[model samples]
Target: MGLASASLFRTCGAYVILAGRSEARLETARQRLGDAQTLAFDITDSEQVTEALSRLPEESLDCLVVTAARVTHGPFAEQPVAEVREMFEARFWGAYGLVRAALPYMRAGGAIVLFSGVLSRRPGMNCAGLGAACAAVEALTRGLALELGPRLRVNCIAPGMVRTELHDRVPEERREAMFRSTGESLPVGRIGAPEEIARAVLLAATNGYMTGHVLDVDGGHTIRQYATRQ
Candidate 1:
């Protein structure tokens, strides 16, 4: 998701800095980015974040988008404690750390776009931890917008089940069923693509008038209150 967002921003003439734990994947993305900088750091580590930020010129960022997250789905009793903690660290704490580290580099008119999920509002049976993390992300976005007001804009993009490598983890039959269910349930009649969410993120970053907004790129998933009866 970060790579997709970075590609979108670079296409729009922004000099992006790619940061993540996977150096190989970052390099692959960098090759596509032409001249963009790549920084390998774990967002969960404060010292690493501080060190990485130190490498960048002060107040050099025009937009900071945090799309790092982890999702674990299973019955709560069956889920491992370590897995739950990892989700919190990746989805919630990592985002918080990035925001804290990037704040100084963001000047007036700059924007920060964070990613959440539809699960935050419409949680499922096996998504308790993910739901909580996403909810926290939305809350943090709102609070940051208020606290960082008038100069810097803070917003969140809550995406529906977008087709990505992340979804490949589900069993093939289950994945198909989920898609079919989403198509039947959502008014838009299909799952969204990564590019669709990327466009929304770009909009949030570029639209100077918008702030503290939780934009749902969820294909009306949030609006459909009742399942469609066939």
Candidate 2:
């Protein structure tokens, strides 16, 4: 999903700096993205983030997007404390650290995009930890928008189910069924493609006046309270 957003930005003529923990993946992105830059830093490690960005031309940064997420799904009672901590570390503090370090380089008129999810607003069982993580992201995005404005803008894209490798954890048959059922339940009658979510990220990153907004790119999932497949 992070790569998708980066690719979208690149296609739209933005110079992208892809950051991640995997050197091999970063190399692949560098090659794949042609002119885009890559940085390998674990956002969970504050020192690594600081060191990495400090080495870069900070003033070159115009937009920031936080999409690295640790996907966790399990009953709250069964979810390990360490797992919950890891989720918050990656989802919340990861964004927090990046913003803290990047702000030094960011001037007025820049934009920062963060990723939340529909689960934050419509969580089902076994998604408590993810929901909490996403809720914190939304809260942070809103607060930062107010605090960082009228200079920088901040917003989150709360996406519904999208066809990505994130769903590859499930078996093909089950995944297909889940997607079908989920699509039928929504007004759009289909699950989303990753590019759709990426487009929203671009909007959040490019739009001058949109700040503190949690833009829902769901296929009307949140509004269809009474709409369900038979």
Candidate 3:
């Protein structure tokens, strides 16, 4: 997700800084991006995020985009407590902490683009906790949009299933069929690509009037899925 967005932003003449928990990944991104910089830090660590922001040469950041999320799909009754904790730490608390730390470095006219998932509003078996976490992001986006308005614009992009590394965690038995079924189920008749979602992320970040909104870039998945559930 971050890589796709970074590529788009970088291509369009934005000086990009890639941040993540993996030095290897960051190094790879720096090589791929050629001219961009990379910062290695755990978003869940407030101190680390603050230190990272401090290292930036710019006195004020123009945009902040939080696109990190990991979710495990399994029956709620069988879900491991550790994985659930990891999800909240990475997906929810990580965004919360980063924003709190990064806000100090961003001036008015700055914008925040958050990532949410279709499962937030379209529940599925074995995804209750994952859905809850995404739903929290949606709520947080709206709340921050309202509270930070006139200074900072906040919004979320709720994307449908995109072909990304995140899907490697889906149970092997379900993985292949899940994508097939999702492709057939969505009104667009296909799962999304990372670049497709990246386009929407760019819009949410650059658009001055869009705030406090959960823009659905789900290819009609949420609404179509909802209809099936009923």
Candidate 4:
């Protein structure tokens, strides 16, 4: 998600600083981005975030997009507590830390775009933690929008099931069923790509009047509940 957002932003004439934990993946993403700068850091660590931002000039950032998250699939009772904690750290605290660090660098007219999943609004089995975290993301966006008011903009993009490597963890049968069902269920008849979600983020960041909004980049997935027909 971060990679997609960075690529889209760069293509749209923005200088992006890509940050992540894995050096190899970050390097690969940097190469794909052509000329963007890479800053490898774990967002969950405050010291790391502070150190990373210390290198940047004050008020130099035009936008900040937080797309880092972790997801796991399984029945709620069967899922491990530690894994659930990991998700919260990644999706919730990580984003919060990024926003905290980046806020100083963002001046008026600057924007912050955070990622939330469609499941925030449309719950699914075994996704309670993920859904809750995403819902918090939306709430944070709105709250920050109100607090930052008339200067910095804060918005969220809630995407439906996007085809990414992250989705590979789902059982094969369930994954296929998800694909088929989502295609039929959504108005667009297909799952979205990361690039599509990236586009929405770009739009939200650039558009001046679109603050405090949770833009659904989903294929209208939240409009109707998923129920089997008799």
Candidate 5:
């Protein structure tokens, strides 16, 4: 989703800076982007985030779109406490710290687009930890929008299941089957594409009056349960 957002922003003639933990993957993505600056850092580490942000060449950021998260799924009882903490460190604190650090470099009227997931609201079984982290992000979006208003806009994109490399860890056959079944179950009759979610990020960034909003780019995943109800 980050890559897709970067591509879309680049297409719109924006100078894009792509940040992630993997130098190799960031380089590959930068190659695809052709004109983007890449910063490789562990967002989960505050020192690293600060150091990375310090290296940005631009004087002020017009928009900051964050799509990095540590995703974990399992029953609450079965989920390791350490793993859950790690998820929060990466997903919640990472975003919080980055935004705070980047505030000095953000131009007035700039936008900060954070990422959550549909599970934050329309949660399923075995996703308690993930849901909590996502919910925190959404809440932070609203709070920050109110606190930082009239200068910087803050919003969140809560996307549903999308086609991304995040699922590659699963066996290919199983992954495809999961996607197929999920796509069938959604109201749109298909899962989301990364590009679709990217479009929402663009909208949030460009729309001046759209602060403190958690825009759902979920392909109707949030409404699926209600739609299926008798």
Candidate 6:
């Protein structure tokens, strides 16, 4: 998803910098984009995030987009606190640290795009920690927008299930079946594509009037869930 967002920005003529924990993956993604800079850093580590952002010139950054997430699934009663903390470390603290580190580099009127998930609003069994973590991100988005307003815009995109490498661990048949079921359940009649989410991110970043907003790029998932409940 992050790669898709970076590619979209590059296509739109913005100078892009791809950052991740894997130097090899970042290089490969950079090559795929023809030409773009790369930064290798562990986002969950505050010192690493600070060091990475320090490389950028002060007031040179025009926008910051965060799409990385770590998902944990299990009943609340069964899940250990340590495992939940790990999820928060990746999904929540990572974004928090990135925003703090990147602020000095961001110019006036800059935008920050953060990602949550549909589960934050639409409940799912066995996703207690995931939902809570996503909700926390949404809260952070609102608080940051209010705190940094007029000078900088902060917003979030809550994406639904999308076709991304995150599902590679699942067996082919199982993954396909899950997608098929999910697609049929959604009002759009298909699962989302990474490019679809990327387009939404672009809109959020470029729309000067949008701030303190949580845009749901979730293929009618929330509406369908609400309707079924009704």
TM-score of candidate 2 versus the correct structure, residues matched by position: 0.94
Q: How does each model score on lDDT? A: 0.89, 0.89, 0.86, 0.86, 0.91, 0.91
lDDT of 1 by residue, 125-197 (tens): 8999888889999999999999998879999999998888888888999998988888678888888888889
The C-alpha TM-scores of every prediction are 0.93, 0.94, 0.92, 0.92, 0.96, 0.96
Candidate 6 lDDT over residue span 113-169, tens digit each: 999999998988899889889999999999999999998999999998898998988
Worst 10 contiguous positions by lDDT, candidate 5: 221-230
Task: List runs of model 5 lying over 4 Å from the truth.
Answer: 57-59, 226-230
Cα RMSD (Å) between model 3 and the true structure? 2.4
Candidate 4: where is the Cα deviation over 4 Å?
A: 171-177, 228-230
Which RMSD values do the candidates have, in order?
A: 1.7, 1.6, 2.4, 2.0, 1.7, 1.9
- Model 5 lDDT tens row, 196-217: 9889999999999999999999
Q: Score candidate 5 by TM-score against the native.
A: 0.96
Selected candidate, larger lDDT, 1 vs 3: 1
Question: Deviation in angstroms for 120 in model 6?
Answer: 0.7
Q: Give the poorly placed runs of model 3, Cα more than 4 Å off.
A: 170-174, 225-230
Better of 2 and 3 by lDDT: 2
Candidate 3 residue 144 Cα shift, in angstroms, is 0.7
1-230 in candidate 2: lDDT tens per residue? 67889899888888888999999989988898899778889989999999989877756677888888888889889889899899899989998889989998786699999888998989878998899899999999999999999989999999999999788999999999999988999989999988899899888888897999999999988876564766
Give per-residue CA lDDT, model 4, range 1-230, as digits (tens).
77888888888888999988888988998888899888888988889889989899999998988887887766788889899888889888899888988888887789999889888978988888789889988998999999987879999999887888787878989988888888777777778888898889989989998999999988888885465322
